[model samples]
Target: MPDIREENKDIINCVLESMQGFVVTDLDGKIIFLNDRYADILQVDRHEVIGKDVIDVIPGTRMHIVARTGREEMGSLFKLKNGESVLVNRIPVRKNGKIIGVAAFGSLSMLDEMSTVATIQKIGHLSQELNQYKSELNKLRGAKYSLDQIIGNSPNLIKMKELIKKVAQTKSTVLITGETGTGKELVAHAIHQLSTRSHHSFGRLNCAAIPNDLLESELFGYEEGAFTGAKKGGKIGKFELANCGTLLLDEINQMPLYFQSKLLRVIQEKEIERVGGNKPIDIDVRLIFTTNRNLLDMVHQDSFREDLYYRINVMSIEVPPLRTRVDDIPFLVEHFISKINKELGLNITGIDDKVIELFQTYYWPGNIREMENTIERAANLALQGKLTLELFEHFLLRKEKERSRNENEICLETVRFKAEKETIIRVLAQTNANVSMAAKLLKINRSVLYEKIKKYDIRTM
Candidate 1:
């Protein structure tokens, strides 16, 4: 019987060694025996921890509960002195149906095997959060109308949105024509976002901004040494960058007449030839062109080609000027204020009613661009609370003065044209039959005024 009891004790010790930290405490909460693993986890020697008060080492309500209840508690997170989280399991030890002591096992926070299961759980939660965030980001990126991004309640703007949605699925050429500052570029971006090509690049070029000499190189690529200062390596242009995507040609009317022929060919053939190169590169591009100028009038005036105008004017979308959509001013102002507040990091709550009233009454010549600029300027100058009418008075007065000056100038020019035409005809009649004298008096080519004479139906008398 003595030998069997000793064997059982050895078996218990071996099993405790294989398991993590284990502690056996008597009913009085005194530590009777502690495993080497348990001592190592607490950073103390096994001999020093043995026969000590368990409450003195692990002082907490959990210890009192285990001593009183004699029940098992499993997998609870507890903070250690070093600020690491630990998982603990407590079991009541009994002999002959009477509870003698409590045995507890604890796993340290940093052990690799114990944390592997926890790490996988954390990673799975993070992956789920990432997927949800990606889905929300895509929705925001593709939205056309919202509270502060796009502002309009007018039927016209609603119609424009419907048309944009209708054409977003097709790979068609779009021509946006409107007065300057009417948000043509905004419409272009909305179309691209709604389309399948939203994942691809949306490249833009201002045709009027680039100089004529550089416009060709900007639209189509150039081989090395194509020009005097050409890059050593061949350059790829906007067309190639916009391939399999969308390209916005702003101020398309300002494209040089010479380049118009080349653009026309590219549009028709769906290919482009690099400058000084013979190879024609095929491109699958969706072209979106914008212009405030009337291309038909330009074609009639010989300033733009008729063929190119028709080619690019495939599906025309006319963006109405802000003056024609005055009912949207309130929504636009609120949107601008929200955008400005976010950008300036201000906590502005709202705009004054009187300030919105003034905006509704004002004629925005520069349209949305002018409105945004004005709002930005006011936001920078405003106090931390709100924007008031008094803060925008100076800007409003400035715009009023500019409008008055423009009107006066137009009147003066009209008077000047009548006076100049009268003087030229009189001078020509007085110096009649002498072409040199007539040219000298008019200070212009005799042929030039003669053409004007026929143009204005002013015969030489």
Candidate 2:
């Protein structure tokens, strides 16, 4: 028995309440109307909330302010009393184009609730993936050497460690100069491990390992389509990747002269422009440059830039050659023996006294690298729990003989070359120059035999 207008109003109310949760407030900041959905979202009884201050009913509601200001906020994140976040629209209601009240429409329907939950779970999954990626990246680029890994306690070693400690406290560029195999990169790693930025990345690039044409791209990165065969999606350069971290450029003397100017500008400007890109990105990187060659001499000879040399020489550390630190030879020997034992799974206790004497007397031209190789060889041959003098004496005698022969220009290499040439000639003649048969007989690859034939100038027919 209800009239048509009353039935239409009821239908409209039911439709609006089912589709969205909404609350209305008057200019006096009093809640005038709210659906059951809105009341449930606020966790309050619908009847009691009517005529109450909107702020009191909903702790952080802005409906009352919107009613007075006649402003609209769409798709804003509104936190509910239960710590749930919902997207809401706070819209002002106008009568005859004059502000009257405000309505807040919230995403509180069942569909919206499910969507919000899904979004939260997606964000959590992405966060976990990001953290895992960062862990792997740290392992790849992190510093692997600490001060204790230097392994010597001689006066020179102690002096060098002290210098490392002092320099690690600053942010200045470091230049580490030393002979090849003297562990210059180890010093660079130690400085990074002790510095304030130890918790961040430590990136290293060997200038000599990269070709001259590709060094710039490796250091500064390149954009997609920067050149033929460029990697897609561009690449992050060393400076950008090592931002707020340390970057070590080993064998910097091998960097081409043309690229040195570019590197100088980057050091001075603290920014780099990717190849095929116009914008210069800022970088905060601590630089450590290492070189075996004397950079100052190169500068004087015009092979290296004087400006670049002075700029990088701000704080220099000269790692002494192993010969000068022979006082620490015993310690070095013990360390190498223990390391080799672990690697080879051998229980060799130690080296004999005569072996240590020989090690101290020998001029190690190859430095620690050569010493390590020698120790590993000895450890492989050692028996009865010790490295004896006999284990290394023959190796030393052969090395001495080789050095003498080299000085007289009659080394084993010449003898072997002559013998190999004669053998190849004999095999070619025996086989009637059938390359495959000759290669099989000599136990060498066919291509190798062909190269030797070409070198020896043997007639095939």
Candidate 3:
């Protein structure tokens, strides 16, 4: 029952509502009509400037210039005063041969959201590019962790450095043994840096962290469609990735016996076969293996292979834990503080001598890593140029108690081996169940500690 003209008007209004950023002007550059969407983009009311000069209504407008020329300025991009830019198409309206007006249309808003999406996609692409080049950068720099970065001046540390310098130029397979956090991985990098292969890539794999079934494929790579969800176009393995370079296999003892034979083949043959493919790919890689556990103990228990042990142990380095190198505490403290000064913009001159003395007294079971983090924490909270005992006292108490409690628990009862076993227990307690610390305090190798614990049926709990 609606009138035809009314229906047509309704349809036109509905279309205009959806036509975002639409405008109309006459030949003299006077505004005739403006849509609500266009007014929102211009940040003005649609009804307020119907008869105003288009240039006066919107500053920096070129529609008036186009009207004067009676020429089209199509596909022009315009920037707004509010820091938003839009793509616009300008068309000249004409009656017969005479030019009438100019019209323009484009996306004039929603630029902020669009720009943000574009930026995130660009960042993702850049991240992929950075990851692709990271290995080459590490090789060109010689080592990710250099000998200079180790941060200690103890005789024991100095001796370890000399050993590293001696073996770095040789082609012997190296086995780096140390307790957790003793910078064994850093030593690995230092070796690679001084090696003849320093110009090539450096690759690393952690045996303990990877799943047993996936470890082989990860090291040797696989062909496309080799298994479910295999990457398209195949993948390169770590050995291939480190061709003519150094490959660090960390937690070497954690590699399963099943895969140990396969690893031995790679070392002896200097070649690898892909997980799904049998073609042997030759490689020229220098091998460096690291273990926190005693591989000899694992071999004795039949968990690790003896032949593989002898092969990797062609050269070995056992870094003494920080507790055994108390003489280097001051140097380590200063080194860490100086490094933190650069990172945090702190000017911590030094810790008080009292704090340094306490630092030496406490058993650093976590070694240099623990010390670095502690210094970093204290530096973050420092008020002046010095770290006082007030801050040191809080961190020192728990470790100090461990030392005192072990000293107090002297088995007054004499039972020879039983008493010796009980003393070992006391040391273990004092060191807070850390095998490396207990061994250091008992003046024995960590392998010896494990053997005695097994012999005495000593429960660490």
Candidate 4:
């Protein structure tokens, strides 16, 4: 009988050694035995793991249903601290039908899998293939649009382009003011791409999107246990992620007044203090801000900080609305059509002359974004060859009626006269209020220019 018991013990030990992962815990959940394979899976020594509470070594074990119920459990997925995924099986260890303890046999791999090396190699190969496919897809998408992609023949646009290029070469803070959908974000990206820090990170945040309460933490990371439900380890914020690079604050006007002081301090001191943290960390970052709202109005209303506004408006660039740059409509239309074709896989070639004429005549209240959407819809519905006027009649006619109503509501002739007045004022200011130079720049006779300037209430600075 003694020889039989020794043989049984030897067989049990052999079975545990040959198994992938085996752990024997007492009824109280103290790990009394651990096989070599079990220690290898956790990357720990088997002797050290023995006699320790299973919950202490593997906290996930405490949540196992088998710990509550004495019945056997199988094929449970377990996650480790190191981000490893494993499969486990827990069975009740009984003697003479009396439950003594629990024995867990787990395999990191799925059922019918052999070794971890084979599973890891398979996952690595799949990841490589997926990345290759994504690269190919992105290449096929081609270049969509950027600041450099905007084409125009107007002198105003040319000067604006030059200013953008010059500012792109510097690290100075830039403020871009424009109406909604006027491509302020695009200009910001162009500046970052052209700067010396182009190789580094380019981060963007919409001041309007984040809540005021969370904005501080989002901009400056918090330490572990900084607040309730905080992450176990600390998290890095966008500002820190963009250190040594560029950070674009889109819709800067929407930033809360309370946070304006914090932003100004970071800009002035080049340092930031994380939320709930005492220490200050220095950062090297170029700041760019964009807003569609009239910041001067906000400053007057005390909705925005005057000092912060001036600090960020060191180099202001105002993007003209599409209405003011009507001459660029043809180029913009063609670009949108091509973009739509590539994105939606449509082969639209050209628009009819009548449609182009109607497009030029219509006033685009929503600017370039509206035009792009119209073109995309037309392209999706049009036949393969050419886009006809009838295909865009609904959108075109609607815009034309709107334009007519606007002209009637605000006396078209009077508005044009006022526009001419403003143009003269701007041209004279640019030419130092010299009539001869302003006339030459405006391509008009000096006498006629003087008569028009006097006819309207145009004043020179």
The local distance difference test score of each candidate is 0.78, 0.85, 0.83, 0.79
lDDT of 4 by residue, 121-157 (tens): 5656676797788656534431123557766767778
What RMSD does model 4 have? 20.3
TM-score of each: 0.59, 0.59, 0.60, 0.58
Which candidate would rank higher by lDDT, 2 or 3?
2
Best by lDDT: 2
Residue 241, candidate 1: alpha-carbon lDDT: 83
Candidate 1 displacement at residue 17 in angstroms: 55
Clashing pairs in 1: none
Candidate RMSDs in order: 23.4, 23.6, 24.4, 20.3
Looking at model 2, residue 186 earns an lDDT score of: 93
Clashing residue pairs for model 4? none
Which 10 successive residues of model 3 have the least lDDT summed? 406-415
lDDT of 3: 0.83
Q: Kindly provide the TM-score of model 1 when superposed on the true structure, using C-alpha atoms.
A: 0.59
Off by over 4 Å in 2: 1-137, 398-461
- Summarize candidate 2's per-residue lDDT along 1-461 as a digit string, tens digits: 77999999999899768745788888788888888877777789988989999899888777875775567977655667666666678999889999888888875433446677786556556767988997787688888888998988889899999999999978999999999889999999999988878768999999999999988888899999999999999998888888999999999999999999999999999999999899999999999999999997677457899899989998999998988999888988888888887778888898889888877777677789888988888788874388888889666885687567666676666888899999988988898889899989998767667767887786788
The superposed Cα distance between candidate 4 and the true structure at residue 294, in angstroms, equals 1.4
Question: What tens-digit string does per-residue lDDT give for candidate 1 at 1-461?
Answer: 37998999899879988666677888888888878765666777778877788877765626546766666777655545444455777878889988888877765444658565586456556767977886675454432432224469788888877888877768889999898898888888888877767756678889979999899889898999898989999799889988887889999998988889999999999999999789999998899999999887677568899888888888888888888788898888878788787888976677888877777777777899999888888777874778887779777798799789879989998898788778777777787746568767877666666656775577764
Residue pairs of candidate 3 with colliding backbone atoms: none
